[model samples]
Target: MKQMSYMINQRYMKKLTCCFVCIFLLIGTVAAQDKEVKLKIVQTSDIHGNFYPRDFILQRDAVGSLARVYAFVQKERETYKDNLILLDNGDILQGQPTAYYYNYIDTVSPHVAAEMLNFMGYNAGNMGNHDVETGRAVFDRWAGDCHAPVLGANIIETATGKTHFPPYVTLERDGVRIVVLGMITPAIPVWLSENLWKGLRFDDMEETARKWMKIIREKERPDIVIGMFHAGQDALLMGGKYRENASLDVARNVPGFDIVLMGHDHARECKKVRNIAGDSVLVIDPASNGVVVSDIDITVTLRDGKVTDKKIDGVLTETGAYGVSDEFMKHFASQYATIQDFVSKKIGRFTETISTRPAYFGSSAFIDLIHTLQLNISGAEISLAAPLSYDTRIKEGDVYVYDMFNLYKYENMLYTMKLSGKEVHDALEMSYDLWTNRMTSPDDHILLFRDKPREGAADRAAFKNFSFNFDSAAGIIYTVDVTKPSGRKVTILSMADGTPFDMNKMYTVALNSYRGNGGGELLTKGAGIPQDELKERIVSSTDKDLRYYLMQYIEGKKVIEPRALGQWKFVPEEWAVPASKRDYEFLFGKVQE
Candidate 1:
């Protein structure tokens, strides 16, 4: 009886031990399933091909570049490892000569923008209006060459009725899923020529965001949703017509987005916006030229394969503070050398030096040079041109290819449009209204000075409006009466050749494609032409960009002398002359002789 009892006890002890072991194993498995994940997301926007720490246009060493950004990103990667996500917010295919070189000059090779993005291991990128300005061939090739996806949820192909680029991209890290939806500003049609966008249609940001949010939540079921928008934070721009800068609008209206990244206006911002559901969403913009980047830290807690809690924080990291990466510089050294050679080639010669500073006060050789070219190239009776650069100088001597960049800042094509003589007068009235104030006394500012000057800002920042909108007309004689009001300030005297200026007749006017496309509302609002009717007025357009024609024109002339047309002047020289000098000193901090 004692032996039987001992055997039973031994068997029970063995079973109890097995049960304890099984419970411990189950506890270990549950503990492993519940985890905390930390991720770092870095974003670069409006880089504009600042690949090296050099300003190819100015031929000077500049602070912002992808080399500096690369260094900072690599340093962060050491801590985050595979948990790091890098993204670009578009406008990377314009601005610097580096982009122009690869975009048009080196047609056989892969785009430098794509090459650099791939080299930096970018997770995804979006399209910008300027990127679209590169036209179908260049941008399509760039999108194809990139290792990562180029996403634009609102850029739809008209024929297929589908997104031209991938709507979004998915990323996974340590069992966490992230979805990034990209959208460009719907204002492209308002600013860009239709041929540039061709068969693509831009949809409203709010509607696109709403559509993508539903799809992402229902299908992706991602742990986090991000918005990468090539737009500004301002919701009231253009009266929200096409929502040019709808980054804030989409964030406030869309429910599922946890974060939104913005660009296009070149303004730096970092803040949290409350959505319709009262949930806070982070929105950030790093501004332009790769000077800064958006850095975000995300902490996610998961239980039973579902996210229980999440915390997000974002800050702007100044790329200028970091040193340029030697590795990045070495890898693309050849391409950099080639671009340098291309820009250094001499195209023509200049007889005299000219500066755009005088453009704000009155007629300057700086702007007249462009006006001369446009009138000559397009055979237009009137030329409307603005000083694209607020203050840049092209010194006398041999003109290099890079000097053309200073001469003409944008890649706008030259356009000759038919405008009634009265329409031209109204346009000039609008331009001067934006450019100068209606002075009641000599003490009043001549230029439209801001009510409160921005401290330590560029000289142009002191103005009430962008200086690029300050258009002056050549090929016509006119006078601006400063004592009068906005509508009555401009007075048309006669044509530059002393022909009668008839308001009833239509005249050929030469302007950039930007203005022709109603970029600043000069044609639509001032000229009283319907937005849709502006296209009908186009008499002709150059095959290449204005800069190309300007270069060719200069080369043909060999040694060109640029002079102001002296066709227009400000009346009541007593009040105008002193005010002009005072305003020039106030803006430029230098007294005119």
Candidate 2:
């Protein structure tokens, strides 16, 4: 009788276990159905023409190859019911070799690069500040050939008050509306000059977002709102350790925004940001220049009358951990191998030492070379070249065409603008103030050059690179007194005919369009002058690019030589900041307060 009771208890326990399994399976089925509404978003930021693996300067091993990205994006889209969209946050041109041109490449158009990206498939992107460095023409070319939408909400043609590129794009996926609003950094005037952005203005970002989001929400009523912003990430928790930067500023203030995709700071951030109204905006910015990509899948819940919670799925890995396309890698390797020989060579050395002292006046031969090139080729009456090159690897007497190109990586137009001596004086004074504030305060800074100085010292690593006493071939002359302080540093300004500078009279000064429209504060144009430094009416200003001019100057031959442009001569007597010094505070003499 006891044995019979034990068998009966075992049978009852088995029945109970079966009942629990059935209930569990039913719950899991519902959960799976809920998650099936998830959306996949594939993002790329700061691609900046990094269509291929490792660029000229960034010679990292196994750094890049779009094959991995392409395959991954395809697989993800396929997995997510073909609902995936790829986006570039910003800065896709001028950083790499592409269907574009920079001062770094010798009339070499990035044809293969353009085709490669077209094949890989990009849906849309924002216009980075560096993208403007390509100027309007190349932008036209790249856009004409691209299969994606290049967007910018605030960037405008000042003449028309209309957006130069599309402000936003909306795609209807099944029963969902995904709206992607693009926003570029308003810091264009800070990084690039006014000349490159002729007839353009970057509107207030906050205001633009408010207006666009409102319009899109009201008219299209997109099911999802995504902001493709090219902004830096926030500071690290304790130290400046890597942290994601998506100016949640827009997310918090701008209503109806669902996600913010940010770039420009070169950080990989994938997380949920809480706005002021207690709404969650998904933000992601993969590492810059094709180092990494962030994949995020999203799901929305709205069971009640009011909107409910949204979810972010974990990032799917591609490229970095897993290898990229073998064919793409093979092609990139072959071309890079050929280009490496030229970039790696050290040309010649400086017999005389160089300097970048007194801030306002000229200091380095690198500056002189730029001025000489601009002046010699354009044959302008006067030309001014600021120190655009950074990280001078050229030891004394060792300079290569590659080194020169590396220093000046942008291709901007040369222009001759009419300006009174007073305006020129003001610009120089501004540069002085910037230099002084940069050196003394060190902490309080705004200008790009003042902040990090590229290689920790733009003027130092860039300016004092090699030495020369080059004569100005552009019919311009100036003198500098190193003994004087910055405000009163400049001396004689002898013209093409050795005439004195007339402050009240208009003089046609030749310079890159970037400087003419005030790329740097040192070159701001006056109120009446054309906003674009390279606007037509000035002689030869309406013509070709600096690279083309350089090509014509060289005539397909080796012609770069050490020549000093006597645009400004500095006195060796006064003590100025040394290029070798890292600390800037000591460089600026304390005020007599």
Candidate 3:
């Protein structure tokens, strides 16, 4: 009987052991199947209010619209499933008629950017420098309306010294964690007025990044870390003393990020930077105006519920090939119509057509119109202005609000500052240095230098500096000698009224707010003035935007004609006149008569 009982016990134990083994095998199989997870992140930066497929400024079919970008995002989402997240790297709250209308005109209603971003279901967004420029009321209201987190680690609150916006956001997908840290360039104090950036302070990118990286690694323990920077790839001093663009430096210095994305100066880039641990980190910049998007794919491997391996791949995806989303257009069709009506209103009439293309080589009606308005409105002795557009033209006929957008590209205010006669001369010298190159020979290109050119290309001229920064002075008689060096290029003859312009005498000068804020270094570097001392020199400032003043000025007249002051010209006209004509014809396909 004992032997039979022992046999029964042994048989029961064998059956139990086999059942446990089968259960373990099933668990192992399931774990093996679910060990790997893939995530896709798409980034859009420097969108600059490109909501529609058409350019309201030019009144033409514009490339790189947000409607097309939405379609691309939809396709990517469909291809990658819910494992994908959409992010905007900032600079979305300003730049176009759509933005300007919703921002200033219809202030009571919801902002266009907030509505669009919420509708598109963006996961996160960073605060750009331009976003800060929109003033606290506009940006703060927009930030509140957004469904996703508006982040800016470096944008600190002056009262508490803490970030005004949320520093970072954490997302989890299929047991894998993702941490995204947002940062903006620390040059806001340099470019903007206290009214625009009140109660906020911006910090250095690399320092802020290092501090957050350590905290996130220890606390969140994320499987992937992403840095969203509203800055350019190159580390350059943009606002005189401040290094506004520093995206590349943060990626190299910060240790834990799996990927970094940036935009501000509007350059496209896609590459990798390895961390101290020898792990490769992907970095991408999608340029500006919604032209491109940064797409990233990350593969994370886990074993026994612990992350084992990770890999990331990033690229800049062009949105030009993508079609506009009908759904998006339909969603905001009414808003578009309203903006169209707003921009289409007739303000005044022009007797003759004008082009800004000639403004780069010499003074023209395009920049001179702005100068005339500046001097007339501010009632200053001298006026300074530049061509805000490269190749915009308005025909002889009725002028509309849309034409004003082409006339002045930014929402800058008119400023009158106190400058000495010597300082004004120095400013003109710097302006011409950016405008023209020293003519070593008459055969050399007069205004532009094109290093590489297509054989049959109609336009081969290229500028060393942006054409918008090529400033010209009105109300002052001056000559720019291309034969001389930079500082000695300008020879001021006298004031336009033939008054003796004494070097020791102080003169009130009318100019745009951008130049007064040291935007182009014409004041700080060229005029040998300190940046901090700029506000003290402000004799007067327009209460409204320069565009608004221009519109009011033209509307008050009802019949308007824009012409060049022609107070300043390039010397050696025998060489310059013909060269200017040839280059103008090559660039704009129009012969200068």
lDDT of 1 by residue, 1-593 (tens): 99999999999999999999999999988876868999999999888878899999999997789999999999999999989999999999988889998888898999989999999999999999899988889999999999999999999999999999999999999889999999999888767788888999999999999998899988999999999999988674441267678899889988989999998877778999999999999999988787889999999989877899999999998887779999999999999999999999998899988889888878888899999999999999999998887778899999999999899988899999999999999999999999888888889988887886542234356888778888999999999988899789999999999989999999999999989988777787787888788899999999789999999999999998988778888878899998988888887777442
TM-score of each: 0.94, 0.66, 0.94
Clashes of each: 0, 19, 0
Per-model C-alpha RMSD: 2.5, 9.4, 2.9
Decreasing lDDT order of the candidates: 1, 3, 2
- Comparing candidate 1 with candidate 2, which one achieves the higher lDDT? 1
TM-score of 3: 0.94
Best by lDDT: 1
Task: State the displacement of the C-alpha of residue 505, model 1, in Å, after optimal TM-score superposition.
Answer: 1.1
lDDT of 3 by residue, 1-593 (tens): 99999999999999999999999999888877638888889899888889999898788887887898899988888867778899999988777899889778999998889999988889999999778877888899899989999999998999999889999999999889999999998977666666688788888888899999999999999988999999877687755657767778878777888888888767677899876777677888887777778888888998777788887888778787878999999999999999899999999998888988778777788888888888889999998888876677888899999999888877787889999999988888788887787888776567755565322111222555666667888888888888888798888888899987788789999988878878778888888888888889988887667899999998999887888778878779987887777777766677662
Query: What are the per-residue Cα lDDT tens digits for candidate 2 across 275-393?
Result: 87788877767766565676777776644222355666646254665556666656566555556665565544445433333223344465665666666666665565554432333
Clash count (model 2, backbone only): 19
Better of 1 and 3 by TM-score: 1
What stretches of model 3 exceed 4 Å from their correct place?
1-19, 29-34, 238-240, 275-277, 448-461, 589-593
Q: Per-residue error at 72 for model 2, in Å?
A: 6.7
